[model samples]
Target: MRHPRLCAFLAWLYGNEATTGRILQQNQIIFPAIFWPAPENAPLDPDAVLGTFQSAPATSLPEVFELPGQTYLRNLQKISPGLWNGRTYCMKAFDLTEGRPTLTCSSGHFFDALVSCDLLEFELLSAFGEVMPEEEAFPEFCERLTLRGTLHALGNPLHHACGRSAAIGISTLIIFPAEGVYHVLLRSCGSRLAYLDKFFHTVPSLMMQPMLADERMEYSVRHNVYREYLEEVFGAVEGEMPYTPAQYHDIYADPAIQYLQNREAAGSARLLLSGVAMDLLKLRPEICTLLLIDDPDWWLTHRQRLRPVTMVDSRCGSAANLLERSPATPLYAIKLSPELELPTGLLCPERFTPPGAAALCLGLNQVRKLLLYI
Candidate 1:
């Protein structure tokens, strides 16, 4: 009721009671209950995952829906003032039309559309008593909303017109190949702007964005993944203000990055593209990937750099500090040997964010046959 435009949109997508019940029965985190797995024989290497940037005229909400959407967003900001409306990449299209997976993205911002999507999810959950909708009542509720068939026009999960902000998130599963241990982060309740107390990838998942103004028109999934790895895994912090191209160059040049790059080049490390999917709750697109370091010596040499903590340090200043603070603490590692399975205790929805759980599940699905050789 609070976000009628969003309600209208959702009604178009899942207004049928049966559809709502089916998605609920499938998975609490992601829709279709499973990721749309990457095609077999699709290029798994990062460099091979092609992306292009298009400068298109920005899209706006219909005039009839604009006021209510803006009101909802303002209310959300009032509730969470720290929400930052930074520039982010919005996926305009994704497909394998070019003989390999390619993402067509454009410039956008956080506040333009994503926060509104969050608002919609908030409203839906609120209607269900601040929880996931009951299977029986949810569909009935959706069926009641006015549907304009907007979402149905958006095509399949792989292709669609961009929303106000179709922010594409990149989530990578990090594995220490020798030990067969893959890491995951437990977001501290005292920290994180969103998804607090949820589990994410060991290396914090990042929405693709240009760190410096000079790079605004460019987008690279590999580069985005590497930057998060440097910050979260190596605690490499970038200084504030007037960022330079050199700063980013140095970041990419870090020995740790170089080490991984060399291993990837040497066939000892792999960066596989798992696939992409939209979070069921938020409708945010996410790119799933798997990074495996298959060298015993690399882990042996750098394992000490991984600082694990049971709790966030009380004096932490920024969300970045929370991520850089403990690379592996407050985390879980699913073993790769004998096939990967999350620990029994972590099999519930509450333990992980939808995108994180989807990445792990989809990444494992992409890598399962390969694990047979391991």
Candidate 2:
């Protein structure tokens, strides 16, 4: 197998596997175009890029989120006959008076019960249920959810080298029954932080510090550039660094931020449309879309309570462009991007992954996937 770091880097630089493959192929390396494994007892066609979009059936379904007249969850659950498709469920809600959190299951219990049962039964699987007011269940599942799940739902990803199972963390689908809205909520577990730390460090060392580093690097570069301009104009008589408005170039021009600003400035719109043909050729056979989260800190913080999730550099607005390159291309992105239109039935957290919650929060299945990546 190719070096995971190199594979990760190529994914970052090219913004998608199709482009990554093209970049490698253009260099004349006969690399495996497919990363995810195809199912066994199948064709030995190495030319095929395995993925769900191609392998899975496409129902031209009208995208009706919650069925009409399904105002209450009980009704929806009854008629839907396995709304979650049998995935486990848990509930979380806030205690306004106490103000921390109040999580429970439909059984009227808390964490202990959930842990004891090894399964959770909740109201509907929605963030509003986690954050809003609700009646308590008997022996509630728990106020704050902390545990793990099996990787079956995670869409197993096998790292080719070791033939090991990599954990994918957890991902939740947020279905807004009333508003007819649906989204995905992603989270990871505590055990995966060390792996994530290693992932972040693989990128430019400075990327590990978090989003604030981008700001600080900009400030430092701006100051340095201004100083250079001043010295050129006034003959190098340096004492304390002097400042002058005229000495400044656009912050975007600072060499330190050149790569970052250039990538963003290119605009996600252009990237999504630039390589339609290439994207089609490289589609995978299992997962429909793959978004690599570049920031370990962001992934750790924002993914709490959702599942074992990672946040790649959302600044890569190119994801939207990459997705657009192929009609059936899977969409991927970090925390934020203009191009990342998550497939129907995925939820994205609007806030940061809270500190110290990394381990307890990741998805059980995602953990299983990372074991493969590592």
lDDT of 2 by residue, 272-365 (tens): 0000011111111111111122222322333332222233343333322322333231112223222223332122111111111111112211
TM-score on alpha carbons, each prediction? 0.75, 0.17
Instruction: Supply the TM-score for candidate 2.
Output: 0.17
RMSD of 1: 6.9
Tens digits of per-residue lDDT for model 1 on 1-374? 21223333343454342211222212332222224456676546654544777655555643433665677677767877977776677777766643455667777777765444454455455554433344455446664322112333445433554333567788887766434454333332221224344334435577777777855523777888888777666666855523577777876688888988999999888888876656655556678788866687876776666445343222333334444555445443334334554443343334345567666676666666575543
Candidate 2 wrongly placed segments (more than 4 Å)? 1-178, 188-191, 195-374
lDDT (0 to 1) per candidate: 0.56, 0.22
> Predicted candidate 2: what Cα RMSD to the true structure?
24.7
Error of 2 at 133 (Å): 51
- Model 1: what TM-score? 0.75
Q: RMSD of each candidate?
A: 6.9, 24.7
